[model samples]
Target: MAPCPGRVGPGGAELLPGTALAILAGALLLAWPAFLNGYPLVFIDTVSYLAQTIVPEMPWDKAPAYGPFLHAFHWRMTLWGSLAAQVALLSWMLWLTQRGARGGVTPAAHLLLCAAMVALTSLPWFAATLMPDVLSGVAALAVFLLGCARPRLSRIEAVAVLLVGVFAVAAHLSHLIIAAAVVALVVVLERRVGSALRAAAAPALAILVLLGANLAGHGRAVLSPNGAIFLLARLQADGPAAATLRERCPDAGWYLCAFADRLPMDSDEFLWDPASPVSRDADGHPRFMGSVALVPEAQAIIAATLADRPFAVLRAMAGNALAQLALPQVGDTLPDTHLALSARRMVRDGFPPRELAAFDAGLQMRGLLPEVAAPFLRPHLPVLIAAVPLALLGLARGGREQRALVLAALVAIGANAAATGALSKPHHRYEARIIWLLPLAAMLALAPRRGRDPGLA
Candidate 1:
């Protein structure tokens, strides 16, 4: 790998003066909540991760990375420390992506880009949050940058970026799928792509981390017991699961037969509604929601659905992908009852009372909003939806290395959309999480280059 222009020291060590400043600036900007509320901002999922951390258990719905990361720093300052780390990691990732492209950027340009992202995108909101949602975006960028420019990266940069990317995937099950999709896309395009192995590295590590974590935490190696139910939820939303339930009732011996007509259209409602059949057994304990039975039932129903109406299933998946790309909303940021309970549990368990109290007070304060932000930022929903194809087209005009950079971003976006839509229902967050890659790519495309590196190109 070729070193960044003017960055390699006598021993081939790359200097990161600008990246350090960017990291500092990003930490300050993203940690605004800690200044406001004496702690970092947290979401419903944040509590869940914290709770799992305290229990040292693998949760059915979430991956184990964020919880452990949070736990590692919780005793020091809880929210702020973890959030500070998140900001630092995110800053480095942005810097690596930029540096990986066209050699490297100046400290001022790196800081400016970080500022632009905070001011022009929803990055700060995500970076400040306790959820793993933001990491999904960071992982996408890392996968693209690493995949397209691995040969140009220093050993230290390569390892750091790989760890960050893998951590992102390990933080969320959905993100694992997203990472896998990006890797697969890179592999398919490897002839034109630079390094599919670089892209695949994070996802591969994520799987290993998941298995290792589950084994250490739960005395098992399985990923998530709840996957099947999420699939069943998506199927229920599309009608086939319910149809199969009705057809297979009585003789099929599944308990879902009795309430097949009452199934909800929305995935959340079906999966979490108190009255929904999936939420409980006859004894009122959680049954199909996260039970082992869900796997077989969901698999059976999906297989039957595809066998019966393959075209319909495909059409629904396509629609789901399109719907997932719609405009993101402020309401998407709101916490729910379940998440609130999780937060309270975390507070009751180990989070400092003072910090929790400050967090409650901070919720009353209007935190930083992007100076020039809107309901939906520039390029809009439709444009973002088409960003991949457009990016690929634009990349065609560039040299091979530049094209590889852009193509990785484009492929990551497409892969995220497809995986999210097919494996799970299309939610705005699914697309919004990775959508920033479009604008990020645009910025990189327009940034002043130091002339392409010979090795990568």
Candidate 2:
């Protein structure tokens, strides 16, 4: 049968010519923050990621994937290109997901959602910033939709979602965990959607990016060469490792024995401070954080800590994860005008002079971005809080598609908290990065089915 006029046909297979325009408009809407900043918003780590293009090795804490992605999209010119691409990808995912949830919609409706998201959620902030955090949510949604709602999506949309998920997994290790959780939840809750089991392959294969990067950088095929060091830092921050360190000091002859008295240091300080026991040498110089010798010892210490204080480990993990869930407020994303001399030098030497000038002149760099963004934070929290009941209502509708999306959002958000807060440290940006999906899920569940299109909600 011929499709009815104005209604999307066959799982949104047709991308009308105007759809591209709508997507671009949506992209620009979400990217308005970057435009206002006169440059992409810079996290303190932006410099580190950008430097990967010119630097010899990946930073211990960052994956090599996002840097290359940024470098390729930016074409070695300005960071704006990378921001544009991130915005475009986010726009496309939101559009397609909205279509699947609604069964179909006019381009105007999708754009309205984009505008609302920009006005009301932290989505725009993450989308506008030069960070892999944006892609974590993208990958979570992709996995669930492709796994549980593939029947509701066109072939083109399926391929695109898979590609997006691949990029996401390649870009960050935490995304790999998020994807795993989404697939696990979908497969468990909706086994009829058997593809959810198969969807795990994308993230499974994406691990090669880390393996390759590790191989090239340290001649190792490990997924994370410094993962143990990170785990140790988290354990120390959470209190378990301190006990182990105290018990095993001097007798163990570990490098960290010298700092046994300072067992429970903050995770960020343990990892980044030049004078930190984790990062310092006997002479007080900063050591390469990914030092090969540290990994095995860190692993040993973490294992001993877990053995000595299993309950403490569990308590810390739960506490940190719960703490992370409550910390979705947006901050620390503004450009740091107070970058260290080394980082400043890295920024200057990393980009062309023109790009450097634009970076320095951004509203964020000038410290004005926060004041402009402050008002939005007020509205953002309420919107997210409202999304809780809205998402529950969405589940009540019992449409597999909407239900899968809601479940994916919860799992992704929870998994992200565990990965970042339990294994690392709780931070606002971690949850803020992916919370936009709650509203998107609610919108989909409430969308009324029309014409021959299946009823969505």
Encode model 1's per-residue lDDT on 1-457: one tens digit a residue.
3322423322233454544665688667655534544446566666668777576555667788888787776663556777778888887777667766656655676678777665556566677777888887877777766666665566677777888888898888877766776677566655443477778889888889988877776577877644777877887788777777777776777767666777636887877677567667656776643445566676676677678777767877787877765634333553333534666567656766776666555542233232213443453454455555656665755434455567666666676776677668776666666667676676676565664332221
For each candidate, give its TM-score against the true structure: 0.85, 0.92
Could you tell me how far off, in angstroms, the CA of residue 1 lies in candidate 1 after the best superposition? 15
Candidate of highest TM-score: 2
Model 1 has an lDDT value of: 0.66
The candidate 1 region of ten consecutive residues with least summed lDDT is: 364-373
The deviation in Å at residue 371 for candidate 1 is: 15
In model 2, how large is the Cα lDDT of residue 329? 78
The collision pairs in model 2 are none
Report, for every candidate in turn, its global Cα lDDT versus the true structure: 0.66, 0.78
Tens-digit lDDT track of model 2 for 264-336: 9898898767788866776687776434558899999998998899999999999999999998877767646
